[model samples]
Target: MTFSDVVEAVKSLSTDEKIEIQLLLQQYLREERREEIYQNFRAAQAELENGSLKFSSNIDELRKLIQE
Candidate 1:
């Protein structure tokens, strides 16, 4: 079904069902965010292993690194 159709169907749900859907959406968003973080961590690990990752303790150096 289309997004608008799904939205219209949700509008017909009872108040309790709407609340349940809100909770489910929250859980799904959290799981998605967690997976995104894990993927980024894996990419960073690969960069570190390949000697392509750079680290800095100075603000000016960080800005220069980002510009590159």
Candidate 2:
């Protein structure tokens, strides 16, 4: 089966079933986003430990770092 087939099957679902699927998809998306944020946090920690990460409070300094 392909994406179109899955879409067609969803189209055939009753209103309640469609609502349930939408809720489930929203939950799945939230979990995926949470995992992505966790991964990014871990990567940033590693970068900090390796002494490659930069931090600044001044806007001019931040702009120079970003340009590099």
Candidate 3:
């Protein structure tokens, strides 16, 4: 439930159990991060397809043009 409870429970497990739990947690975290990255990529792709993305060729040139 809480971090302290998790730690206490882990402390009671055998070495093999601890290792198995650690691996399972690591895999779960990896999958979560991968899904987050994929969602970001999909959103960017949609923005590009819908013409909602913009870019400037030259920062200095753009600034000069804007100042005029």
The prediction achieving the highest TM-score against the true structure is: 1
Steric clash pairs (candidate 3): none
Query: Model 1, which residues run further than 4 Å from truth?
Result: none
Cand. 2 Cα-lDDT: 0.99
Ranking by TM-score: 1, 2, 3
Residue 18's lDDT within candidate 1 is 98
**What Cα-based lDDT does every candidate model obtain?**
0.99, 0.99, 0.91
TM-score, predicted candidate 1 vs. hidden true structure: 0.95
Q: What is the TM-score of each candidate against the true structure?
A: 0.95, 0.91, 0.73
Over the stretch 1-68, how does candidate 3's per-residue lDDT look in tens digits?
Answer: 99999999999999999999999999999999999999999998998999975557999877865776
Candidate 1 local lDDT, 1-68, one digit each (tens):
99999999999999999999999999999999999999999999999999999999999999999999
| CA deviation > 4 Å runs, candidate 2 | none
lDDT, candidate 1, residue 8? 100
